[model samples]
Target: MSFGGEAAVIGSRRLFAIHLFTATGAALALLSVLAAWQGDWRATFVWLGIALIVDGIDGPIARRFKVRERLPKWDGAALDFVIDYATYVFIPALVIALGLHLSTLLGAVLGVIVAVTGALYFADTRMKQPDNSFRGFPAVWNMAAFVMFALMPSPAVITIVVIALAALTFLPVNFVHPVRVVRWRPLTLAMLAGWLVASSWFLLTEPPLSAGIKTLLIVTSLYLLCVSGVQQMLPRRPKAGF
Candidate 1:
């Protein structure tokens, strides 16, 4: 009956479609969950990978469409956060606890810690800084899980890494959001792209990522982890994310 939709309040169908596109990430997360439950690690990550792509693009697309003005009824950011928690925190926690070298009980406990802390981290109002950099570790368990799988570290080491990263959740360290963080952005994007390439290769091939590819993942992760320190070096006391 109208260009906006069947109802005037429905807003532009084209813009509403973008919000719906963002919502599809939840469906992808569900697929990832099922794949993880089946112990198909590769398939699980593949689904998560697709979901990640969706999460990465939806924001810019929504902005490009001025979705907020066009579709005032829906909150894209909140929807994105909900889908992100599932894909970035919950499912990755599930995969980590499932695939780690630890016993079922211990793994599950770690998963609970990850899930709980990650949820809390997301709720922190200061989670994002003025430059869009994360105020802390950002609870990107998906990447952590990927690194753990690629590295295949010992159980004790894996446990320690998990615990340490969880502890770092509330720390005042900075972590870059590849697409959003601007300083050294070219390098940041390159590292992000390198990670995607290496990880995709690892996923496409058989088990045991090649040493070189694994090395690439590690190097990229290290850059991401320490990039904040680089920023901090510029100013004695970097401005707080708040």
Candidate 2:
């Protein structure tokens, strides 16, 4: 096969793999929500943790399969935008609406966080053609933090933290793209595994409301740390050559 043909084949496999991983994440998210609805906190945490694992793995899985190599710029951009919206917009709102009724202050804080996070997400979406670095906080990390905080009690404290973190997202900080380093892959996997186990334990043993809240906090916090820490720990991947 010609070089271009070989690349296309590799990229196609990778793209399909990424789609599968994304689907898995979506499935787990649904399961988590279902678990929460049933007042099975452990199950909820387990599923959410699984979803987080899927999210962590999808990019590397895509890279390993070389799906990105064949994807058209527009299609890739669209996929990224969709993923961001699902995780940042739909998932957080769903989690909050389902799990806890927020006070007005808490709602306001979350609203600001959502708005700022959305702006950053859109900024990244718009600047896809030239391969520019993202300028502000990553929506995924903010959502991860917000979700975890919500899982815990104290809507007031969570709101404060969210407001503070929302401001930090837009602050001038060097945020690296995550998919650059292989070392972090193992760490992320380990954390995800731990989350799964811990969440399962809580679901099985603890009181429903308490168990769910605790597991949610633990999983969310770990996820946020991974999102923020990965940027610092991993080197950025070089721009893909078309």
Candidate 3:
């Protein structure tokens, strides 16, 4: 091949590698499931956490390398959605069952709700808006459930939160995407960093989250939950083409 063609081939290979990297999250998700099956909660969270990191980084890397532009045949977003459903919805449902020690009947019912709503949300092309914010709750059950795990909230409280969030999935309200949302991005990312650190401490340590870390986590969560609501009420800028 000519030098130019050789360079093009190398670049394509790099893009493919990035796709492979994103696909690894599926493996991690499976590992998480197995870990959870064994009642190895820590290991489960560890795998999910690693998968979370992979999910967070791959998008930027893909965008930076122009993966979509170069590899039009590969549906990176679709691959991501599959893994995301595992880590973000399915596994979290399992965790909710195990973590809360729910009866099998209860767990199955709730899990079905999570999986069904999550699948619908994923298939919704209007899930994300032009501003890079989610059109609804975004179905981040993993984080929602994880926070509940850390806090060890009452089962009733947990059920209420889960049901409420699932309902929010269909709402027209906006939810921020942290890295993707442009408004207050720096501050949002800073809060996200704090949340990751605080949440990591909870995941790494045993149950009975410390007062300080729990407070930090709560603060960050409230910011994430409320910021977009505030933005929703403000007048909209002209929607930009994505």
CA RMSD per model (angstroms): 3.6, 7.8, 3.2
lDDT of 2 by residue, 1-242 (tens): 99999987886665776676676666666776677678654456556556656666766666675555655442543554565555555555445444455775566557556655665656653422222233445555323443453356677766665565556566543332434334345555565556545545544564444655466557645563445444644566666221
TM-score of each: 0.91, 0.57, 0.91
Instruction: Judge candidate 2 at residue 48 and give its lDDT.
Output: 59
lDDT of 3 by residue, 4-42 (tens): 999999988978999999999999999999999899877
For candidate 2, the per-residue lDDT at 2 reads 100
In the range 106-154, model 1's lDDT, one tens digit per residue, is: 8999999999999999899998888888887898999999889878899
lDDT of 3 at 184: 81
Clashes of 2: 2
Q: Which ten residues in a row have the lowest lDDT in candidate 2?
A: 125-134
**Which scores better on lDDT, 1 or 3?**
1
Candidate 1 structure, TM-score to reference: 0.91
Worst 10 residues of 3 by lDDT: 233-242
Model 2 stretches with alpha carbons more than 4 Å out: 1-21, 24-46, 71-77, 108-112, 125-137, 141-151, 174-200, 208-242
